[model samples]
Target: MADDSHLRETPLSRTELLRGHFLHVVRDTVRMPDGAQATREFVLHPGAVMVIGLLDDGRVVMERQFRHPMQAVMIEFPAGKLDAGEGSLACAQRELLEETGYSAREWAFAGRLAPTIAYSDEVIDIWFARGLTLGERRLDEGEFLDVFAATPAELQAWCFSGEVIDCKTLIGSMWLQNVQRGEWVLPWAASPGGADAGESGT
Candidate 1:
């Protein structure tokens, strides 16, 4: 692997700008590798998990929720931010059940993604859940969304047609398509006892 220390930036000082329900904003003064100073402002997230749940009949669980920022109902996979001291797998399982009322007997850690790498220190763990069983959904207070199922093909078509534009969902579509084609293999296992994976210190 190539060494990247030469491109690293060291923080000189940091100032908290905003601390909301789940978003923490901060501004920082950093020393560039070239001995120059710069300012960087970004959001600090607790990280999150996005589950691409596969049903036995080849459909995937999906959600349509109104994102305040987008001001539109957006289609996405079952996802949520990690609770305090929560692991990625645990968050995935909780989100899958709470947001969609589905639980999986088998799971595979797909990968991770930083949707806003340039502006936010948020990293979302990608998970694949299969052998699903449906139950009653438990939505959080003040949370409103519609849960449904769509085939991988339908989801991919939306990605191409600019219908499903959520970055995580778009990326999830990529993972689903490749996995369906057998190009990307996932490490499948039975349910885990909740150990964290790929958590970024945001």
Candidate 2:
């Protein structure tokens, strides 16, 4: 393996720029690998999880919600950020239920993704759910979304046509494609052991 210490930077000092209820911004002075000082600004996030839910009819569960930052209605998989001290799998399950009103009998840990590595320390765990059983939704206050299902081909077409622009969702589609083709295999479990979400009626 190649050595990476030559690409490292050491933090000298950090300053808080802003701290919103859910977002934190900070600026840091760091010593670059060449011993030169530089300033870096970024956001601190609590991390998140996204689920790709499989249904009996060969469709995958999805959602449509308006993202304030994008000023657009985005197509996304069910997902949410982790609460304080919450396990990733637990948060995934809670979010899947609260947002979409569905649960899974089997769960799989897909992978992890860092969507905005250049500006934020945010990571989202990718999950796949099956064995769905739907119920009533329990959306969070101020949350508005529509839960739906889409065929893998439909989703891939949308992604290619630029209709679905959410980063997590785009990656989710790629994962689904590979998984469906048997190129990627997930370690599925019946229930949460320490960590993993889905869809049915709602």
Candidate 3:
């Protein structure tokens, strides 16, 4: 099948714009293939990174924090917006430690997700961290959160029962489960989890 033959371009024209704080806003006029036109507003944002930290005992670390936009506290995987010129893996390491006060000797890039593609341009890289140790949590000035660890079953229950409402966290948990069952493998897993599989503080 020559799928390219069916492709049709959507002509666009800029109508408005704004730029600030890692976001670029633009209102674009698009002409559909059917000859109709519409204006779409979009925000371009720098991507982010998230971590699914797993303990040696197979427990997963999560955090509970208040999301101002949703006006509710939610349990989510530790994550942060990518700093300018920062590598995804580095951002993942920094976020995990800052949010949970923990670091891992082993790290693996799991996957990526675009949480809101229709209106926002943001990609979130997911990671799996193991060989854990505790460290000083260098949280941003306005950040506040509480951390907890849960087994696979507990995590699933939390997701299905509405305790964990963050989409990214749920996706990260599912990915970790698949990886643990050997359905997925980390990009870099030389020795995998070994006898020294548990929690530690830095």
Candidate 4:
């Protein structure tokens, strides 16, 4: 079993299938672990970050965005794909501000989640933001979403009732549970201005 576990597939050749604005797809011929050749196709993503914004009143900021692929509105933490050469923390902060019109004075790196492991190389860095101050939302053109706050208990209820089906948010709820129960520890850093309002939500 140990010897089999060490086996790995080696890519022999790769061909670009499609390159879009944010996603790149490629097909590769690889030498399989069992000494067989196979073709694999996958999307290459720039990765992303999801921000769990916890307010002073114990509510979390969430977004209801219409996901075209799903053909439904998804209730999710404010998140976005990383911009070119952007750091994960920067992306998280930007996404929270852009999508929800809020900024946090404290930031913690909760963890990471792989949303689609079977087909795409995508990684989402999970973040917990607290000490929030309302700010004007700077959404991208054509991006439309409704932002609102929900208590942790309410969010959990939605999760159990099949209302919150987003994979990342579900995984994030697990992290929230552990963190709230003192089973997990998150190291937080002070954001610039530390709760002072330099922007307006209006």
Instruction: Indicate which candidate wins on TM-score.
Output: 2
Candidate 4 error regions (>4 Å):
1-6, 192-202
Per-residue lDDT of model 4, residues 1-202, tens digit only: 3666447889899999999977799999999888899998999999999988999998889999999999999999888898888788878878888787888899999889899987899999999999888978888999999999999999999999999999999999888889999999999989754544323221
Q: TM-score per candidate, in order?
A: 0.93, 0.94, 0.85, 0.92
TM-score of model 2 (CA atoms): 0.94
Task: Give residue 153's error in model 1 in angstroms.
Answer: 1.2
* lDDT digits (tens) for residues 99-184 of candidate 2: 87777888889999999999999999999988888877888899999999999999999999999989999999999999999999
Stretches of model 3 off by over 4 angstroms after superposition:
1-11, 15-17, 20-23, 189-202
**Candidate number with the higher TM-score (2 or 3):** 2
* Candidate with more favorable, higher lDDT: 3 or 4: 4
Worst 10 residues of 4 by lDDT: 193-202
Compared with the true structure, all predictions reach lDDT values of 0.88, 0.88, 0.79, 0.87
TM-score order, best first, reads 2, 1, 4, 3
Pairs clashing in candidate 2? 89-196
Runs of candidate 2 exceeding 4 Å displacement: 193-202
Residue range 133-174, candidate 3, lDDT tens digits: 876677888889999888888988988898887989888878
Candidate 2, residue 162: the lDDT equals 97
